[model samples]
Target: MMILSWRRRRGGHRTTKAAFSEENLSTNLAIPTHFLCPISLDLMKDPVTLPTGITYDRESIEKWIETGNQTCPVTNQVLKTFDQIPNHVIRRMIQDWCVENRARGVERIPTPRIPVAPRDVLEICSNIMTATQRGDHKKCMELVEKIKRWGRESERNKKCIVENGSGYVLSALFESFSSISIEEHKFLLGETLSLLIRMLPLGSEGQSNLGSASSLRCMAWFLKEKNLSSCQNAVLALKELLGLDEKHVNAFAEIEGVEEALVKIVKEQICPKSTKASLMVISHLISSSTSSENTISRFLELGLVSMVLEILVGSERGMTEKALSVLDTICNWEQGIVKARAHALTMPVLVKKILRVSILATDLSVSAILKLCKSQEGGGDQQVEALQLGGFHKLLVVLQVGCGEKTKEKATELLKLLNQHRGRLDCFDSSMDFKYLKRPSL
Candidate 1:
């Protein structure tokens, strides 16, 4: 036993020396776990800002950013770029810096004071809102003319003095402007808060573009409502405002801050049975799947999927469909781990249900089948070909019968690959019709 033990120790020493040999591998070792985002601990995307308002796109890119006066996302102290993140032994122990998010800990910002209201407040507000609702440009222009008479009045009278009634009327008036002039769309996002006093969430009139409690709620409501007809340009405006495009000005306005805010809300309300707010936030993230692939991927890495699925398991079908659509988008990428995670999370019963249904244009069935084949053990020739065959058949049907041939050539090539490995095909299913799997011309 001693002789055997001595031999084992000597062999272990030899193996260690071999591993360290310069001829075997590069001395510059890759940081296995550190290749990911410090915040997400996943592959980096267009890195974003937290409440600390610090942003970076890449590590070296981050170094060039002036984060000196800026505070750290994990530590509140004023920051410089962290030079030794991967080298920090404590980072892995705490599960990346983002686990202690600085965004959530940001102090409540005071609402910015709004410009004083117009005198004859009720009259001007009613005229503007009425014209906005009717989509009557001449009438709205007429109201704008009348508004010149009231100048700036006391804050109390601005939106509160609607002559006949308040509350529900004002809400309806704002809601009615899902279609309105470009200027009116801009006015509503900020001004709606002043109009929404005595409501559930107070407006941050002085603070934000969608400042007040009421305005944020209204903004949240608009974003969450699935009906296209019930939406507004404010969403587009907000996002556009945040984006670097002057051309997209009108398209992404009110939703810019709202998107960032939604992420914060999702993290904040993480508890047993949070109200509808968290679910609404998840819906927005899923809705944004096609917004930008990198941004969507970043959102996923920030823990949106698992948290959403956990809390909103019995959510409406629309929500589930949106989530699945996002999964399809992520899975479309070659060798995306996010897709792998999504597939595991999608229950077996759900997969079966999807298969049993009469296939629709939007059905993700082919993608799912391809993914299944990729995951099978060995990832060897026969299994890979079978999966590609399933995808090819479905894609062909879609091109021939449903959609056009945008991806048909790619599908055809995949079919050709199946044939290349057809010799190895006998190792698997006899039902795989290799005779029909034609080789594509190079």
Candidate 2:
């Protein structure tokens, strides 16, 4: 046997033996080679033997398998099965060694919890359905808590839960409880939504169950909750559910306070993810042919135009694109155009973003500016503002740098519109580089 010795640092918190210096190991007592995991070279906390007759730490081997490899680490042979068997004898020896080396600063590893099995997840889902059918709120809540815990325990556990059909049961429960006032079952609803959020990319049946009007109302109610987690999950779930079908988009538009809640989420800037989800929801609603006009008016009344302009000023590339996309959709309506033109930041911000962001952003910016310029009330004024703010130069650059075909058309039309004002405005400078032009303060 090879003998190795290392001085353990006092009060050190390192987990792997490899972290220790080779110089420190020159004079320490020998540790059995079998005691260390082949993968990590650390003491095995939960030793298990593979089908290849190789024993390694359970976590290390499981991680190796999870990363898409199918071969035994040491044997370099194809694994017939990924099942791992607990090596109780090795675990006992390792524990005894730790006890014997307590004076050397070695700590004993505690036994690891058994991983959740598929049968365990199936039993929980069956019980949840039973409890839900019997009106046993207490039992249902308890089982839901267990499912939440297991889902959070590991990626494997979450996959097992989803594959075992927990999503159907949870969706049914959510739909059933949505008809009741939120205050009556706040905790139960909140927990169920949290779990459902984890099991996303829900199946068709699950999405159908959650896409009902009442369920959408429940999601809107959760969006108004004081708890940030509930708000985040609610909006995320709503976005997914709405995406299942176009009819759900129209239904969501009719939900009381749905528009308000989404707008408030965007305005408050709760978190970036929630904000993006809310924007997507809004986009769906506004794009729906059945409810486009009503949805646009409602969102405009909710002050969406100003909020999006504020976002465009400081947000990053992805978010800026979304905000502009929403803006462009809103500008499709005359009311949307009027509201956007009325805002102080509308012209300057739109002109500033013309060529600065991505090609998609340039497309949206040009489209929105074209709509604003077409506004009969302020058409000439917007054109003059575009001229003074170097809109003429930016439009020229858009044609040069390349943009979408439609954007190209809009750019050409906008160039003609701005050119009409170029001779009238004394501040128009064709020779000035757009980069050096001073943008108006927001």
Error of 2 at 195 (Å): 1.3
Residues 259-298 of candidate 2: C-alpha lDDT, one tens digit per residue: 8889999999888999999998898888777866767888
**Each prediction's whole-model lDDT (CA):** 0.40, 0.84
Once model 1 is optimally superposed onto the true structure by TM-score, how far is the C-alpha of residue 336 displaced, in angstroms? 5.0
lDDT of 1 by residue, 274-310 (tens): 2243343333444442445555555566665554445
Q: Pick the candidate with the highest TM-score.
A: 2
Each candidate's number of clashing pairs is 25, 2
Assess candidate 1 and give its TM-score to the true structure. Answer: 0.33
Which stretches in model 2 have alpha-carbon errors above 4 Å? 1-29, 67-71, 74-78, 427-442
